[model samples]
Target: MIGFVILAIIALGGGIGVIVARQPVHSALFLIMNILALAIFYILLSAEFLAAAQVIVYAGAIMVLFLFVVTLLTAGKDDREPKENLAGQRLTAGILAVLVGGGLAVVGVLYPSRAIGLGLPHNFGNLRGMGVTLWGPDFIYLAAVALMLLTAAVGVLVLNRPRRQVKPAPRLEERES
Candidate 1:
């Protein structure tokens, strides 16, 4: 109850931060915070495997990928233009977003779902089930995809790494002085 509320606030706050963040890296970090909060929510919902997957996949792999791309994009950017001209636009967008969100909230509260739940199946969110599925016939495809993505990320990093600027050797005339 209380935990859910706290997690909800955290998730919402993180999501809002992600949207309003000026820097791509900061946005990615805020997204990670939101992802982590959702992972906790999955645990609260008795979906342990989902929680783990949320943290491992989204918070870990995807966030790293996002950071890699952000780093690659911003690495050489030393200067940026002032954003004062967009202040009015930002405020207007914020107000419109709040109004739309509030309207949706009101509609949801006024008309809640009345459908009965079918509930989770046996071992629905258990790790063993997920492990078995991963190790099943399609394991090769999954493994190959994972390998390719990881290799690609590493390759990008290696290719884009900063190289040291080396000075050339002095000529005989300069060395004589």
Candidate 2:
């Protein structure tokens, strides 16, 4: 319970940091923090499979892709102040935030203990069972997905790579000059 509260604070702080970060990379890093905290929460709830998936898929692969895209796309860009002409945007966001917070607060008040896994099936999130299934009849699908992810990562890298800009060899006349 104490650990959950600490993690909740960290997650909230990371969420705020992601929103308030000035740089896109910083925002991505903050989002990674928030994601990892959520994964830890899953671990605390004994959802090992979810925690592993969250860390490996979201924090590892997705975050890497996000950082790569953010850095590569924004490379050599001039920093300019954003033109915020959306009047009352902040006011509207604040009101929505307050409403959402109130709803959550009421839920928390109703379920103070926040019971988890009330009617879950046996071995519902067991990692061993998932591995057996994936490696048994689902190996082909897993291989396909892995190939897709590899191709995507390669494509993003290729897109962001600097072109060699090779120049034609100087002609004889130009070389003589």
Candidate 3:
């Protein structure tokens, strides 16, 4: 229970850091921290396969992909853009964040009685059990996620590809000369 609470705090803090980070790379690092905390939570829940998947898939692959996208977009430049002078944007953002936090606190206080408990089988944490569960009913959702990732990767590649430069035709005088 203590471990769960610690991991939950880490996850929550990392999530907030991800949103609060200014640089994209910093945001990705924060997201990785959140993923690691989630993996730890999975371990605490006796979901070993989920823990491994969370670390391997989300922390490893997805974060790497995000970093790559950020790097490509930034082209290794650290030039920070000038902040927008939108009046009250910061105040509005702060108010919205407080509202969201208060709403979540309210939900946390109120939703416990409505929560349902499900019993897990003995082999639920094993890879074979996870495979069966995933490949059985949730295969379509898995495939959709894969397809979405592939599409995003392709889109990034397309956006980052160098365009062909069409040379202008020489002027008549230059051609004659």
Candidate 4:
């Protein structure tokens, strides 16, 4: 219980840090920390496969890709872009935030407290169970997700590829000079 509490606090802190970080790289690192904490939670819940997947797919691949994108975009320095001046933007944002928060609070107040039940069978989190699910009717969805990721990675590579600048042949007079 204490460990869970500690992990939850760390996760929450990481989430907040991700939002509050000024640098994109710092935010990505904080996001990685959050992903790791979630993986730990999965392990604590006896979902070892999910824990491993979370670490490998999210913390490892996705975070690395995000950091690469951040570095590529910023070139390791803050690009001080001018802030946009939209009139009443902050006021509008504050109004939306208050509305969302108030709605959530109202829902919480109305919701009844009950002992939540685990909805899975005993072998739910095991490797075999995951395999059955992944290879079963859901295989097409998984394949589609994998394809999408591959496409995005390819897109990033294409975007970052150096273009071959075709320099016009020097004028004959300039060559002579």
Candidate 5:
């Protein structure tokens, strides 16, 4: 319960950070915080395998890719400013945030300690069971993840590939000489 509270606070803070941050790199870092908080929640729920996978796959690989893209695409600090006007955007976002927050608060009040009643399934946190479940019933998802990672790898490679250079022609007198 205490763990859940901590994780929820961290997740909320990260959510706000991601929204309020201006720099792409800062936003990516905030996203990493959110992923880590979620991983902690999984751990608290007795899903050790899922927690590890979340940290490894999301916090490790995906966030690394995000940072790489931010670094490669932005080039420098000069590119951190907003590309478009933020006029009236804050009001809309604030309204949406309030709606979501109110909905969540209502749900929390209605279903307090709801997860406590969920009995742990057999082999809930067992490594072998998780392995079998992943490789057996969820192989398609695993394959999809592999393909997605492959696509992201290809994207990174393409993005970072050096541009072709074109040499300027010599002046007429130098060419003639």
Candidate 6:
């Protein structure tokens, strides 16, 4: 219960930060907070490996990349201009939120007493077990995921970096004459 409350608070705070912060970098940091909160929730659900992976991937690597981008870009220090075009998108977002909220409300009302399955042993969080699962049988999937992330990171770096121009050497004076 306490874990859930903490997660809820963190998530709410992160959401508020993301919306209220004017700087894109700050907003991205808030998103990192949200991802970390989710990782904690995964830990609470006894998914230690998943929680660690979430932190490493989302909070560490992805957020670092976001910071790199924020640094690389030339967004001004001033607060971002308010968007007049947001009204349409805001309405759509609000409608989607309502639909999701309504679904959750219905589920809570209909199955208030529903229980979830908690699988596995106490030692499931051990590194050995996780390693075995990752390398022993699911190696292909793991390799694929790693490859995808590497490709994406490389692609982003390549796309964002400034390109260099090759300058031609000047001809000798005699040759020109």
User: What is candidate 5's lDDT per residue for 1-177, written digit by digit as tens?
Assistant: 677778889998998999788788898999999999998888877899889999999999989988999899987657455565568887898999899998999998788886778898778876877878779999999999999999999999999999888776567557643
Which number leads on lDDT? 2
Clashing pairs counted in every model:
0, 0, 0, 0, 0, 0
Better of 4 and 6 by lDDT: 4
List the pairs of residues colliding in candidate 2.
Answer: none
Task: Give residue 82's error in model 5 in angstroms.
Answer: 5.5
Kindly state the number of residue pairs that clash in model 5. 0
lDDT of 3 at 111: 83
Q: RMSD of model 3, in Å?
A: 8.6
What are the lDDT scores of the predictions, listed in order? 0.87, 0.88, 0.87, 0.86, 0.86, 0.84
What lDDT would candidate 3 get against the real structure?
A: 0.87
lDDT of 3 by residue, 1-177 (tens): 688778888999899999788788888999999999999888887899889999999998989999999988977687676778688998899899999998997898678643337667758898998788779989999899999999999999999999889787677557743
State TM-scores per candidate.
0.62, 0.64, 0.69, 0.64, 0.68, 0.64
Q: Give one digit per residue, the lDDT tens place, for model 2 in 1-177.
A: 799889998999899999788788999999999999999998887778989999999999999999999999987787576788888998899899989998997998788663553666566567876777789889999999999999999999999999889887768556643
Among these predicted structures, which one has the highest TM-score?
A: 3
Worst 10 residues of 5 by lDDT: 76-85
Between prediction 5 and prediction 6, which has the larger TM-score? 5
Cα lDDT for residue 35, candidate 6: 91
Candidate 1 lDDT, 1-177, residue by residue in tens:
799889989999999999778787898999999999999999998889899999999999999999999999897686465668455887898899999999998997789666527676667679876677668866998899999999999999999999889786668457743
Number of colliding residue pairs in model 3: 0
For model 6, state the Cα shift of residue 107 in Å: 2.0
Report the C-alpha lDDT of model 4 over 36-125, residue by residue, as the tens digit: 999999998889999999999999998889988998888857556568769788679869977997898689668944633636675778
